[model samples]
Target: MEADTYTQSAFEAELPIPRGMARIMRFSNDQPTNHVFRRGAHYWLDLCLTPRPEKARGCYSERWGPHRFERLGEIFLVPPGEALHVRTDAGDNQASIACEIHADSVDHWLETPLEWTDRRLEGGLDIVHPYIRSCLSRLAEEMRHGGTGSAELAAMIAGQLAIELARYLEAISESPITGGLASWRLRLIDERLHRGGSTPSLGELAELCSVSIRQLTRGFRSSRGFTIGDHIAQTRIEMAKRALASDDSIKSIAFALGFASPSSFSYAFGRATGVTPLRFRQRHLRGRE
Candidate 1:
């Protein structure tokens, strides 16, 4: 695993990432990515392999914390200004997921058939694993060959990578969120629809907020008139409405939302809207009921 970057130069785009969209990044031993530090303004996430540097390292939010973080395999929800830093060497190495998604993106996904958002998961290095290696290998191969639709293809590959990571996190950790969820939960689950958007199956989310699942979800029905998960779904439907008004493929939309496949996305979309995502988009865009 020598250091190299498929996105060798700064890769920037103004492309429309329909709601629920996601991406995956892999850093091997060969490629040493400088690993961008994220500003909430910049992107939703920045997964990296590079670890704390021996020398001084500053990032978008604040200076790298004075801690030694080796053996990198984690997904963390960085607070507004906090950043995880990494510097490479023999035992201490560079590897990570530079995933930057937006809240708008998460909302769009809810409209489709995805189960939950990263907000639903516990953020930690334990999230990344080798199960994704095969997929990443295929993506890298595709990147090496330039052709028509390469960028779009690259985007697709990246999206799947994020989906897989999300799945992995959902499967392994039983850790609940802790602390200060009053504000964090409100902000994180803002796509409110059914209830107050406060119930707790997103075990990872519980970990992120540092609160017990019981406190987060107890008697939520009496307060919100729906289950916490239902509230999350309704909020997702609201997000789907916006995507319906935009111009994007239903397939892309479903993928962004983390459907196991497009068929699932379509099925879920139809269930929610009484029409397919495309039909909903068309009907909504044309101002038809």
Candidate 2:
């Protein structure tokens, strides 16, 4: 599909990665826009950069084959040779990153011929995968800031994306969806938390699970027998322990783990483990010695 077909959104940037192309788009229209693609020759994955406002009227309703869904603040994947129709309502100005991967790259990653009948291959909308999200987010960031190592990083990310996409397809195909957060959803939460960077907020985690904040909290509690906040606190402490083992300073680790300040991290760590971070590290080093 030509970029100009949808006047509501404009292509802000496009970059070439290994076996694919990535583009950033910005939507600034006041009216709803319609997009139709007739059996594209490549796999398309789009990640929303700007989330939809809670009270916004804008949303994306997509039709792929016989399946139809309405979603926002989630990644949309369209497999090769699938007719896709999308209607996007205008709301807050939004930006998205789209990556188009060639069919050969996908097949190569899978090491087998593509199966069109596989439900996993019939990608629709609101696909939730944390690893894919991390890769695409990194890709978008690299494209946004073209630097000396951008090309190498983009190529590496594309390769990782291809592998993750294949694995995700296989996993979803074999796994059945159930009530309350599934095993995969829990894994998503774990992966996102274990990912070393700023911790994700509750809303961000909800969006990652393709559910509302309330739903995520209730479902997680029901399934895990503990609150999501509890899980996050525990995970943060574990991460802090690992970082403390390293030579990095506690203040840096605190900021990296989304703590407000060194004092706050110390308080939380002490509450969780009955000792301050420095004390824990001292004990750990002493044991090693």
Candidate 3:
């Protein structure tokens, strides 16, 4: 695959097509940048890979403030004509990938109701699923290497991405957001949890949402089928899985996630997955062999 290189404003983008229904590009910026991504006719996916995942920040809507990212491999979907503003940390070179997929390809794989095709799946959809991350990582590697069979790999990944997006939309529809809470507040809670912040009390959550505790609890339960505390635990486990896969030490990950001690973290992890963190990491590592 050949690369289409260009520079616009302060950022440089390299777009490469390797025989697929998706167009993939990598972007790099040396300084803080404010650019509105003009939408095309197709749906889009963007993933940030630089400035350390934890330090990444961006605003999907022009009206909203930027927020710190909680996990790596988070996927943001951009609907046509909608603008996304991204400003990376200063003094660090920012790296990201933006892939544009044709709507027809998505429609073919998605089994959900027909109306969801028009829902847009909302931008800034955080993707913490390991399987999706694995597929995207392979697609990215092929995009960079462009070796033999790269075209086939790219096409397969493109189709897989569409399938996953459809499944995600279906899941969201099953737990549609209820009234009584602002969207920004929900985003705030998500950001705080991903940053390893302590699980917030019901009163704290209610105050942030500007609603009574009972209403907030009822709203969350109705939408997610779980309490806020359970959601926090689940999020922390997901983050822990990512961290464990990295080179970071288990003790460090435990502390980063706000656990009282390494022992406590191990206990919690064991209880959640029926295996120790070390054993889980080892199993995953072996599977990669």
Error of 3 at 217 (Å): 8.3
lDDT per residue, candidate 1, 10-95, as tens digits?
A: 33222323332233343332434344343352224443322322222223213323444422322343322234454443222223
User: Which residue pairs clash within candidate 3?
Assistant: none
Report how far off residue 145 is in candidate 2 (Å). 1.6
On lDDT, the candidate that comes out on top is 2
TM-score of each: 0.33, 0.55, 0.55
RMSD of 3: 8.2
| Candidate number with the higher TM-score (1 or 3) | 3
Superposed model 2: Cα runs more than 4 Å off: 2-5, 53-67, 70-73, 121-124, 174-289
Pairing residues by index, what is the TM-score of model 3?
Answer: 0.55
Q: Arrange candidates by TM-score, highest first: which order?
A: 2, 3, 1
Q: What TM-score number comes out for model 2? A: 0.55
Greater lDDT among 1 and 2 belongs to 2
- For residues 1-289, what per-residue lDDT tens digits would candidate 2 score against the true structure? 6454457667878889987899987766356656554436788887765443222211222323334433332566777876556666554455678899887776776755655533343333544555787788778767767799888878989998988887766544323333568767877997999786777889999999898999899877655434688768766775686677779999999999988899999999876555588986775565344
